[model samples]
Target: MIRRRYIDGRYGQVHLRENTPLGEPPLVCLHATAYSSRSFSALLAVLDGKRHVIALDTPGYGESDAPDGRIGIEAYAESIAEVCPDRFELFGYHTGVSIAAEIAIGHAARVDRLTFMGIPHFRALDFAAWRSKLAARHVLGERLDQFEERWRFFVSERAARLPLGRAFENFVDELKAWPHGWWAHDALFEHDLLARLEQVRQPTTVLNPPGHLAEPSRRAAAAMPDATVIELPEMPGPALDLYADTIASLLLAKQFVGGAVPA
Candidate 1:
């Protein structure tokens, strides 16, 4: 079974959802912006007996305490790293990809291998446009209808590929992040992820699920020294609940080959 706990971090208490029954180095997971470690709930369950996994709530996003203000990607990486094992594999999704890359680069000795589900490799102009759009759209207002509108948007747009209940779960996670949720995006757009990815020396796997980031993930992979792109054409969304088994299998296969598990 997956379990939850809190650990000391640079920010205060960092929350984690983990399954530690397996006898292997843990797979440290990081989630996308506005979401939390809860995003990996399904995946944690899937890998419960087979692999040790720990998913962290990025500071200010989940049960973790929010930072004093907007911090850079390096800060996010460092804070999360404070709670991670001395050595392990890493997995990241969306904005987590940026943070994971930074962690792998900064803490190279600790991270053995890397896996990324989405890479946000936007051009300078594109990055600015995205920040502008998110800033204008993600404001939390006092009106109740504004909140309803956000809910409807998630149901129809952001989490369309998920079931109604699953979509609602995501929506709730997004709400929990509130005003600081946008901080991750701010740091993401400002980070030179390509440069950081190039500096990552670990073997990396980029899962290319059908999404806006597919092409960009490939572009980002090319910058890395040892990275492979695996296409998941059937996965239209990054809902871990729906694709946990598939994701776990791919990760396990890589781990086995990399000697993360007994051959």
Candidate 2:
């Protein structure tokens, strides 16, 4: 059963809801910056029926508190380590992908596998430059034109006035930031795991969305010999069940994330 409880209540804290007795090592799922664990409630429930699934409200998102005012991706990963210290698997979507990558690498012993869904590793920049770049709108084709129209609608005039930190963050990030504390856009954007994929000792899996991020994400996954790239037909929303059976089988068989099959 999924029950919410606070864990690691320091500067930053998280609300963890998990099933403790699935008789399996937990699959710790981290939602993207704008999202909370609620997004995975459906999929988690299904997976939980077979094996335990642990999802937490990252500091500054969901019901969690952001510690020390502002935080970066590293600190977010650190929070997970403190709360869920046992060995487990890591899964993330979009921005969560970056965090999970470092989490697995930062505490290699704790992570068995690292999975990224809709790997959106979009780079961040100074607000002014960011806007100018967006305005330039490099037209790749009709597809990009359609995307640009949608993105344009997403960014309103008032949003342009928000502080760089606030602008970079979505609903979750804003919630985590202290009421009157400085924001921390610099910390999270400065580093990404694509360049450091080789450092991740855990077996990596990247299932990308059908868009610009796919090609590069696929290349990044290739950095590790143990990595696997699973492509799916274009669809909307998260692909939570694309390989759920395989993941479960791999875990039950003790085929750890280092890409080794069970004995």
Candidate 3:
């Protein structure tokens, strides 16, 4: 069973969902842009009953309150670091990938292992254009129709596999983070992804799913001090939800040895 709770984070109240709340060296999971810890509900259920997993609703995304002013990846990492234990395994998808990398680099002593999907890489020119686009989109309009248009587009492109009710819920979550919804992407595009990855010293795994476009993830994996890259070409589309069993197995192998993390 998943339990809901809150942490009085430095920036604001941070919400979390956990499978095994008291299990040690928990697997700290982060979600992509506009999504919450709820994204990992299916994966949490598949893990063994004794294996602890905590999914954080990153600040400005879900139930958590938005930070003051614009912040970078470092700030986002610090927000999570404040709540994490002395050492834990980290897992993330999309935007969460960059956050996980930042945490590993800045708080190496606190992170034992890392796993991520989609390491974002952007050319200077591309980032400049994206920044302008995101800046314009961040301002939510007054029209309900405009909101509906954006919601429909997001659902069709990203959440098609989800049930209608769940997809709507995601759309609502997106609406809640408006004005700051683009903060994470902006931070990611502005940072040097390769440079950041090079700083991470922990044993890491890059989980590549077919149909996902992320050349940077492969490059980052190759640059890490100790890393493993696993490409699941046959398992396509949002690997986190569709291939929860495969991912859970991988973590179980690396982090769960005799019901505990290896020393």
Worst 10 residues of 3 by lDDT: 118-127
Best by lDDT: 1
Residue pairs in collision within model 3:
none
RMSD in angstroms, candidate 2?
9.5
Q: Look at candidate 3 and tell me the lDDT of residue 98.
A: 84
Q: What TM-score would you give candidate 1 relative to the actual structure?
A: 0.93
Clashes of 2: 4
TM-score of each: 0.93, 0.68, 0.89
Which candidate number maximizes TM-score?
Answer: 1
Question: Any runs in candidate 2 off by more than 4 Å, and if so which?
Answer: 123-186, 238-263
lDDT of 3 at 145: 76
Please report, in order, the local distance difference test score of every candidate based on alpha carbons.
0.85, 0.60, 0.79
Model 3 lDDT at residue 33: 82
Residue-level lDDT for 216 in candidate 1: 87
Q: C-alpha displacement of 175 in model 3, angstroms?
A: 1.0
Ranking by TM-score: 1, 3, 2
lDDT per residue for candidate 1 within 96-150, as digits (tens), equals: 9999998998888999999998788876237667778654446667877767766
Off by over 4 Å in 3: 48-50, 124-136, 156-160, 256-263
Stretches off by above 4 angstroms in model 1 are 135-140, 156-161, 258-263
